[model samples]
Target: MKFKSAFYLLFFFSAFLSFDGVAQNKHTFEIKQGNFLYDGKAIQIHSGEMHYSRIPHQYWRHRMQMLKAMGLNSVATYVFWNHHEILPEQWDFEGDKNLAEYIKIAGEEGLLVVLRPGPYACAEWEFGGYPWWLQNISGMELRRDNPEFLKRTEIYINRLFKEIGHLQITNGGPVIMVQVENEFGSYVSQRKDIPLNEHRSYNAKIKDQLVRAGFNVPLFTSDGTWLFEGGAIDGVLPTANGEGNILNLKKAVDQYHGNKGPYMVAEFYPGWLAHWAEPHPAIDASNIARQTEEYLKNDISFNLYMAHGGTNWGFTSGANYDKKHDIQPDLTSYDYDAPISEAGWATPKFDSLRAVIKKYAQYDIPDIPAPFSTIEIPSIKLTRVGDVLSILEKQKSVQSTTPLTFEQLNQGYGYVLYSRKFNQPISGTLDVSGLRDYAVVYINGEKVGELNRYYNNYTMEIDVPFNSTLEILVENMGRINYGPEIVNNKKGIISPVKINNIEIEGNWEMYTLPMQEAPDLDNIKKNDVFNVPAKTKQLQGKPIIYEGVFDLSEVGDTFLDMENWGKGIVFINGINIGRYWHVGPQQTLFIPGVWLNKGSNKIVIFEQINSELKSEVKTVKTPVLNKLK
Candidate 1:
């Protein structure tokens, strides 16, 4: 009787695991008549979107567990091409970029995976995730049937598949579906220059690339409801993005998916994305809960666009194009007003939505884990370490008759210093042609004026005596992530420098300041003499590097309050956390505890616009994401 009881218990547990979609055995995941089937059983994919590139690897398991606790059975992620391959043929999959490890963690947490590996993932990421080097390729047309683009894309997909392709459900991995070419229908609509059929053909080519690269599971395309006609592939499944109406979803899927029925909302927004100057976007928790209930009741599978909106970290943020703000660069903190805050804490929306999910979840939901605790640090005073010129002295400069773009210089992100020595005193309206984003003009190390592309301000007044040096520091805020303008998006001064409408011709010195990592300031201070100012004062638009160090007995996640500082990038130890701007909205940069050391930790700030009278930064347990300047 005891043996029978043990056997019965074992049978019951195995059945429960299989029914709950937790069993890791090789299973068939298919789309039949628009619904998903796992091992011949109908299943609803309660999934959420989370970028492994955005979240710290140390906390990936925690975030996965958070999603599981919210009753999600699946997790979706976009494999950013630019992120994996920072440079052409130079790939990085170790450390935080470990994509396979992230997916395995999701499976360990009993969640299926949906892979959206876009050579162009417009998640407000840099260049829509296209490597900057692609622009340097001759005749490289992106998202089209261009041979140059396809050749590189095929290479990228094959390399990516080798990393996570075997993890598909057919191979005993969690990945059930793979997406091809993100939102191509919307892109085609925006770019009227390209024919509709060409866009569709290009989409088909990408889908073929995925299959050839060894993706054996179902493939799908996601676009807004109105975009399905152009976005959907003939044989592949179609998913809706941003469609709240159940009727609209069904109609679109039926219209596009050969009258089939496995409908899924690929990107249901719990909270909207936040821009730099825009008000924090928030959808009421009740509204999300209501929509969720409707989805569950109607048997519509859905995935939260951002279950946890993580930080953009470093120069990874992208900008948007519109009539309102010409080049609206996204804030470094991609808080997105999401269910999980930038620091990985669950919000009211998470709680309320989780409650709704509990009712429909096939299995018991795990208890939500406690959010990570934050540590506050005492104020640390920063010293003026060195100027940009001092740092440039250590690097090589390219001499060109015309100013080159960042790509021309083989530089991806950060600032480029364009300088020319004037033989005679020159005083006139200084104009820069094709200035990609922002520039700070200086004459003999003194700032003269500023030019911003967002406001379409390209010309500025300058009066410098003869034999003085004129330098224009151009900053690539971010590449345009969406729209047709991306084809023309190139950083730095792409044209000739002009004075009073006359093009100034001569030898120009270009300095590359790609701040991919923090500069060795300690060595610079030791080797070079930095004259300390007698008193603290405003930077007067002069870009300066400030360095500070603080010792910690213990460390945890914390927010570095940058209210007192100005527009610049912050680096902890040698790793760049992200950029900070005084222009309101995001006043703090989230620093993960794993990135922080228990001993002495160094902080470096490359202040361009604003710096406090007292150069200092404070740490807070809570974030100041909503605070706008």
Candidate 2:
């Protein structure tokens, strides 16, 4: 019997090579018209973005091992959808807002992933990534096809594709490409010329609802290669993201047909984010390592809009508008002076783009991951105990007496308190016709006034005394970045509140302050109240509190410089580190070392300027104050 059929044909060829090495260790991924095949071959992604709620799940595997030691085989996130459903049906992946363990630790570091999920994703985030409770419903028309914005963008793309569509890459996982709604042709166009075709049938109905909620891969859009030939689709894969070169990426690969297959660049801006007084915006890591060595010497495929610009942390940052109308608002330190530096460290443009991506990477690159861990805390003091109108006049019978307007008190994000009872306290020019950026004017509580939309004159007049009760408060201090007039942003006084011009309305009292529920102050009364003041004495002002204490046994996360303090708000152990303004671009204030508490950690600081010299707690792990330049 021929030696027992050669021992059953060598045991069936050794069990078919051990089941094809367990299907290539199971993290599949295959796609064609833009490459990315994997276990089946054709690869070349190089991705980077980085945003697991802006980095901090214990530094997400030290920022995905410094993006795979810079040769970056893949990693691109966006997820946001209001930082993972902040409420309505509540859902949060995990601490530091874990988006599926930052995509299974970018597949335990081997890499490969590219999600986006949007619901909008303008990247400078907040609102651009939608979800301020979807602007309290009621006729919301964002990114078109408005049926309450497609029923909350199909319930946040079907609960984020049922928690990250089985981790993509064709189900075995590690994604591969998901980006459907991000750059909608950089804000939809093609009207009278007609081809808009309902924005390509709502992005082919979100790619047939992500292949009927399963996402089979091969689907791409990206836009901005001269507006991707009227927002591409015809069998998907258009690509081209921004700041082009190489003959504009070979005319976007001769408009699809020549099949350039995968030449991404989905953002690339090495640095540029600031808005308020506008001046600090630096970018040269040798021109982002000579435009990333001309996109890896033309093998082209990019990402980097933020290789690690972390910390939009709260009120989720976003705003940009330049076609000269100016606008600007993106500085919660998404330090897109990228090449990783919002505290994951590694900069000099991350060693000049990791030596030009390890000289055009063919393979083997991993080494760079060490940095994260800093503690300075020198001299530490920042005291200010009382005022915010004396805690709203001791909670005037539990607040909200009407005047509400940070969108009818659903209160989107921090600071808003209209207040008005002016029996006739006329103070000449006090106009505020839609000042959405910064204002602090009082009368009875007495701080006289101040208004600034970067000095575009929001009308100011002093000395009002008489009937007393004017209080303005208004401090969105962020929003309006690049435009089609951001649907007229509109915050407080978008068209009212005049004094000598007479229209000061009455009985107003709205104080929403969506400080997202933090201020409980344990029934007030805590009196150790330190005081420091007298550096030369200049503490003569409106509602100042400032208090400080620090012994921190050790918890983590730091960044609180707020550039020499001027605008207000900073609280720890009591929480709220949301607002800080020296005006010319936001200046650092993230705190969250899990909200610090290893021992003795109070730190309050209201400071609208009763400036007696305290503000100095330097615990940096990088938020780039450049020592307030």
Candidate 3:
């Protein structure tokens, strides 16, 4: 008995020693003179950007392992301000939204970290990563030095710092560097011969705020290599952000410190983002491999903008400008054709990058894990629960105080309802001046008007046979992408409602439909001709709401394809899947299967446009929506 007790004691001591070794092995890194240092030793940082909310939590460790094997020493991530504190004072740190777990996993894989906690990250994200709730604030000017903007920004920064401040290298954590504001130079100094003094002033204010908020690590500003000189602040390190090439890198080194420090590429674009209606972008893997090799050969530090470009998911994707004066919003799939594909699979680019990194690594290359399995789903059907229009009638209290324009209403995230009573027969051009995007007009439950932003005009001649109540429901759809005109993105009717070239002013009831509440179909009315359905009911074969049961018995990672179905929302068990439209470009929806249950998992879909198309859900396979011919 004494011998056995001695053996158990020895085992406990051994386990303690093992844990201590692991704790010692874990390192915190710092950036000094453009080079990251691990425990006072100069180390090159090859980082990649992968948001925690974008990729599945189960895949976090796997993706980090892949990044480490590919010769990357760091994982650069953006802590989206809106993603955290999604609701007021409500914070989520589990599943895919687990930011701390992501960083901790990077550390476990023997990689450092660069945290880009953007109160405003403009990563082609919705509202430039700012919370949609801020738009509800009256006269809120984002990215400016306004008190309201600063107050919210301060709260976000303070809260985020509280969560991850001690995680920085200075505090014995893995975070090496923190970026102040992303690509500010490009936005502020886009025009020729424009002095960047204002831009610098704003940056200084941001830097001061961050420092005061407890981000003491080395702060860097990233801009395109050629444009670095214009946006560079004196004390802060200026890093190049774009495709990693020799000439541009050399130029960045010169512009940053004049040959006094190491060179770094903050945003090495492995692949470009795609906008709707634009051809899907495909970057050559061979070119990326060659550029990565060149950077490694020169001992330059670079971070792939998106090592694993996951899904924009929900209404979080942003828009961009095209050549035809069209404002193109980004698709749901953020598959930027990156080294690690959206599904977290290692592509040919991944292998090539691994080879290049292995050639220069002082340590042995780790084993590349096998790709995750794919499961194909059979076709199924979906049903409509009830109409959305009738529900609006129940909430007659949704009307706001005082007749408010779209700007005054300050409802920027979802749909808006504008209703007014027309007392007499009217015949003239009914004009909705400054309609932000799309609007549907109805008179006494008859669909009489439709206005779109394609032509930048929202005018239609209407014949009101008698006194009737005119209701116009306008959807924000999304804001404009290109040109200086993007700043004036006001939803609903921006100007005024007019008839016969005269402004129609009366008791105009404006309903703010931010869609923050769960949709209810029972509240809908058949007389309500405008609203769509809320829930689906059908359950059978083709076009049937496919109800499948699976045992997640173990939590893992996977993606969901949303391209095959029409416009509708998805739900896990009972949670809303957000909205998915088969409208060109965005073909797949991301399902971080990690959020699923071990047994009896449920998926409910509500397809708005197509009732006959078959829909399926798979565990392993990623869905790709075919373009409508």
lDDT of 1 by residue, 572-627 (tens): 98889998877768888999999999899999888886434445778898888787
Residue 588 accuracy (lDDT) in model 2: 68
lDDT of each: 0.83, 0.64, 0.64
Query: Model 2, poorest ten-residue lDDT window?
Result: 14-23
Q: Per-candidate TM vs. native?
A: 0.94, 0.36, 0.82
lDDT of 1: 0.83
Candidates 1 and 2 compared by TM-score, better number: 1
lDDT tens string, model 3, 232-272? 77777778888457676676666666564557788888788
Tens-digit per-residue lDDT, 393-501, candidate 2: 4454223434445765556667776777656556678778567766778777666767766555678766566677777777775555333455555455566667678
- Identify the runs in model 2 with alpha carbons over 4 angstroms from their true place: 1-68, 73-184, 190-262, 265-300, 310-317, 320-341, 345-363, 376-379, 383-441, 446-466, 469-473, 487-494, 498-502, 505-558, 561-629
Q: What is the C-alpha RMSD of each candidate to the true structure, in Å?
A: 4.3, 19.5, 7.8
